[model samples]
Target: MVYLDNAATTPVHPTVVQVIQDALINDFGNPSSTYRIGKSVKHALIQARKQLAELLNVSETDVYFTSGATEANNWAIIAQANKSREFGEGHHIVTTAIEHPSVTNVTKYLETQGFDVTYIQPNEEGEITVQQFLEATTDKTIGWIAMAVNNEVGSILPVQELGEAAYEQKLWFHVDTVQALGHLELDYQALKCTSFVGSAHKFNGPKGIGFLVYRTYQEHNHLEPLLHGGGQEGKMRSGTENVPYILGMVKALELAKKDITSNFEKFEELQAYLLTSLDSIGISYEINGDQKNRVPYINNLWFNGNIASQMLIKMDLDGVYISAGSACSAGSLTESEILKAYYPNQSERWSQSLRISFGYQTTKADIDQFIHTLEKITKGKIDLWHSNK
Candidate 1:
């Protein structure tokens, strides 16, 4: 099967799998125990955190492990909102409409809890400018929430500039780096965000393991514990650590960091190959995000007509697994909120775009198979279909 949906999740790397397996078999002791086995396990956890921190260019003390990106996003946004609302800090938030549901849902909940939120819409190219955010910022705005890279269209947000804005205004800024973790080079120090999150599965690591990195930019900057139990993660997040998964995640991160540059160059080649193949087939299509400010891993394509759902089925049947949008909402195959925000008036664009993402394993042969299958499915009606503006 040609799996071009790496933006949803990546296949676990062999090295990471071996690490997790070894941990489960030989390092099974709980980190909390005082025995020698436990002491060694505990040291491993600390080292995992340190290694992950080094990869993201952050301090080890700032990282806290969690279930995944969803939980990390919730903990960061909800905790900050609660702090601002309860402690009289501020009751307003600034975020983008194209953010992952984990963020949008939290902002929606905050609205019901009496905190005002501004959802910034992306421009036609699926890019949000720093000026738009700065203009929306008000004195009552306490925090800013956004993603480093959009999962749907791969649009790279102005996170650095937004971070600078947040820093100058002394506002709490939390970035969801879920899609950016391995694909983009993140200078955590320069980001100036109060916190940012990463999910292991997106980077060829084991699922069910991710981390959150928060900093005390202000004296009151603190996140209340989301879970109550053995008081893990410095008491900010509670639950027994998944040592094997942690090992797998850190190993995956190490591999990604080592190969990021080479992978990027490879992706550039793949993108060119894809575009040329499409043109050779005379298939009418357009990229769905800001061409200049996007990642090469995920490419959202707008085909000629409202045929994404049908194309998804045809591709799946042809053994080329792609999706119309985020896998989280694929059960319903709903319109992409990311595209909606970018082209609010153009329903055709939002409902018809296919998300074709590449991973470390994706190859030129896979692309050839995808294009061939796509050509067969789109045969005869190619003239009837016209790519929307």
Candidate 2:
């Protein structure tokens, strides 16, 4: 099958799989234990942290692993909110309308706790400008959270500028880089944020493992721990670490960094090919966001006279897999909130959207087959697929 849903998750690399298998079979000792085997396991964990730190251009102590980006995001936002309360700052937060549910839901939950959240709406391009964020900020605004790249439309935001603004205002800045980790050239120090969250599954690493990078600028911890136990992860996160998954994530990240340039060029070519082919097929379509600013790996397209859910089901049956929106909101028949925010008046466009993401494993042949299948399916030829189903 041609899997075009890399935005959701990627297939783990064979090398990473092998490393995880080896660790599980040979190094089963707990890193928190004081025995020799445990010490060795602890060393493995340190090495993995160091490797990832180097990849992100940060110190090893700044990286803290978690169950996934969701937990990391929750910890960062909630902890910062708590810190704001302790400092007597009013309950106000700044975020964007196009953020993933990880950030959106947490902010919603904060509202229930009496915090005021300003969701800065994006322009038609699915991007929030720095001015928009500045306008949203108030004296009570204690934190700013946004995503580096939008998970649904792949729109790259002005996160660096926003982070700088937050720093100038002394408001805690947090970025969800789950979609940008493997696809973009990331310099954690350069991002200038209080912290950033990422998931390994988005980069061909194992699931159930991700990290939060906390900038080490001050002596005191600005954020509190969500999980408390043995005081692990510099006393910011607690739990016996998943050593095998950590090792596997490091391996996968190394591979992604090693081949990022080549993979980027490949995806660019594939994107151009797919769009051109779609035009050649004489299909009516409209791109959801600003094509010039989006990452080449993800394409959010709107086909005329087609429903996203119906098209997704047909595409899956035809061996070309894609998604309607974020996997977190998959199977929901309503329009995408991101699209609605982008086009507040044009509500019908949201139902026609499909998110097709590319990966390192995607090839020209795969795109060609996908385009052909999509054309046939969109041409009102559904009897065969329905009969087979």
> Over the stretch 77-170, how does candidate 1's per-residue lDDT look in tens digits?
8887788777787799999998998889889988998989999998655678888888999878899888999999889998999999888988
Model 2: lDDT of residue 372: 75
Question: Cα lDDT for residue 289, model 1?
Answer: 79
Error of model 1, residue 290, in angstroms? 1.3
Tens digit of lDDT per residue, candidate 2, span 79-128?
A: 87877867687689999999999999999999999899999987765568
